[model samples]
Target: MNLTVDIGNTRTKIAVFNGEQFVCEEKFEEAAPQHLLDMVALYSPDKLAYCSVGSGQPAFETALQKLSCPVLHVTGETPAPVTVHYRTPHTLGADRLAAVVGAITLQPETDLLVIDAGTCITYDLVDAAGNYLGGNISPGVEMRLEALHTRTARLPRTEADGETPDLGYDTETAIRAGVVRGIGYELQGCIRHWQKRYPTLRIFLTGGNRYAFSNAVRQNILTDSHLVARGLNHLLEMLP
Candidate 1:
């Protein structure tokens, strides 16, 4: 068994995978070293791997310091199954790395567009030849709402459902429509642009808001929430 930790900007997802099978999965506001150690002790995984985008947390390293098995800390330099041509590789987000690795593993030998709809919507591309082309990033569903509230005085904070109506009757609904519909168009535009360049590109959607926008368009998007975990497992498989 193996443990995969994805420490994001706001939360950390920990999962126990026996090969490709996940026995337990959880999301935490933050991961403490002791909490990670306790999980390892309880699950007794043979090895552990973690990716972090957060600032220096001594607790995480402290817990790994005690581990007897291989403890791989995912970094920009980590060996990937595909070739990355990122000019500023260090600036690449860990979440994006995980998502790209996930996409390549899930559908090898195919052109891919990995779209993650979370606090920030990211669009990453991997060519059919296993070369990772750079991608674009933009504010996500919630970030758009928050940005609107902060940018203007009269616009109240809008609450979002997974679905936003096109013809909004209220202020909140209008915000929702503008944000959600705008995002949908933004995503579709990217797809169209990429399709013109690479017609066979397959679109894969991941992250928390994937379902909310799944039915908004028909772009052949595959919703797999466990993409990062799958990538983590694939990374473990390639370890020497």
Candidate 2:
């Protein structure tokens, strides 16, 4: 069995996998030592892999070291299942690379476009031969909404919720519609442009706000909220 941990800007996810099969998963506001110890006691995993974008807790790392299992802390320089062709490999986000690896693991030897809608919406591509080509990053839903409120004086600070009308009836609704629906259009445009180059492109949507944007875009996409965790598990398999 393998234990995978992904620490994001907002939350941390822990997953247990038996080979390619996912056993269970959990989420925490923070990655604490006790949380990892509890999971270790329950799963008894022989191997562990973790990736962190934030400044991780030292105690958590110590806890992982104490465990009998060999732990692999994934970084931008980590050996991945796919060959990365990005110019600045060292500057690449760990989550972005992990998502690309997870996409390839889920569907090997296929052209893929992975869109992760979390704190920031990231788009990454992998060729059929498993080359990790770089993609773009854009402000996420909440970020956009907050930007409007903070940057401008009149725009109210609104949360993205409820239905977003095509044409908003009032100010709050208009902001909601513009922020939410605009993102949907942006996603569709990106998908269309990419598809023109790669006709057989497969799309994978994952992250916190996946459902919010997935419903807006018109495309055949596979959604997996645990893509990063799954990728960490795949990375564990590649380690020597």
Candidate 3:
């Protein structure tokens, strides 16, 4: 068994992988490292790996020190099997790197497009030949609303859940429709453009906002919100 942890920009995901299959998974808004340690003991995995893109590493490190298992924390500098070709490899987010690793692991020798719709929507590209080509980031649903409210004068702050309006009638509904549909269209456009360049592109969507898109008409999208953690486990298997 292996414990896989992904400390994302917004949330922390912990997974217990029993040979490439997750037995159980847990989520946290802010990672309580002690809870992670307890979880590790509960799972009793001999190996642990984590993807840290935030400041939760200290607690993770502290927990690892006391654990009997070996914890491998992945970073841009950390040794990975895949070669990263981002212009500034060091500046690349761990989540992006992990996503790429996850994409390639899904199927090798395939052109991959990863769309992570969390606080900010990120679109990353990897060639069938295996080079990581960079991506685009745009404000997501919540960010779009927050930016409008915080930056502008009158837009009200809104949350996404409990009966999302399919059509915009008034202010809040209009904002919701615009943000949601705008992202849907934007993601589709980007995928279309990228697909034209690489005829067969595998599209995978991850991150929190995946639920916003689970249904409601997407042409060729494969979603697994737990992709990052799954990818971390995949990377661990390739390790020496």
Candidate 4:
């Protein structure tokens, strides 16, 4: 068995895999290291691959050190199946790269657009030849709503899980619709543009907010919440 941990900006996801087969996954808003330690003790996985884009948790790091199983810390420089082509490779987020790796793992030798709608929405591109061409990041649905409320005076703070119709009726609905639909439009435009370039581009959507925009975006988008975890495990599989 292989264990993969992704400490994202908003939450931490832990997944267990029996080789390439996914077994189970758990998500925590603020991960308790003891709980993770307990899981490690229970699973006794062959390896644990860890990736983080959030603030460092000393407790978790300390706990990781005590674990007997090998823990692989995934970084931008981590050796994966794909070759990253970016000017500032170190600046690239591991989640983004992992998503690309996950896409390739699911559909090898195919042009892919991996979109992760987490704390931030990332759109990463990978060629059919397994090259990570880089991607763009945008504020997530919640972040957009929070920004509007915090930055402005009158606009009320809206949640992503509200009544988001084609057009909003009231202030709250307006904010919700605008933020959600705006992302929909963004996805459509981006997908269309990319499709023009890569005619057979396959779109993969992951992250917490993926379902929120599933209906909004009018495209054939494949979604898997455990994409990053899967990629992390794949990275572990590639290790010498």
Best by lDDT: 2
CA deviation > 4 Å runs, candidate 1: none
Put down candidate 2 lDDT per residue, 1-240, tens digits, no spaces: 999988888888899999978888999998788899999999899899988887757888888878898999888778987888889988888888888888888889999999999989999998898888899999998899999999998899998997688999999899999988998898999999999989999999999999988777657799999889889899998877
The digit string of per-residue lDDT tens for model 4 on 1-240 reads 999988888788899999988899988887679768878888999889888898888888778767888889898888888888988988889888888888788999999999999889999999999888988999998889999999998999887786887888999999999999999899888999999999999999998989887876647789998889889989988888
* TM-score of each prediction: 0.93, 0.95, 0.91, 0.97
List runs of model 2 lying over 4 Å from the truth.
none
lDDT of each: 0.83, 0.89, 0.79, 0.88
- TM-score attained by model 2: 0.95
Q: Candidate 3 on 24-113: residue-level lDDT in tens?
A: 889888878777877876888978888777755676667766778777878766655466777777778878878878877777788889
18: Cα error in model 2, Å: 0.4
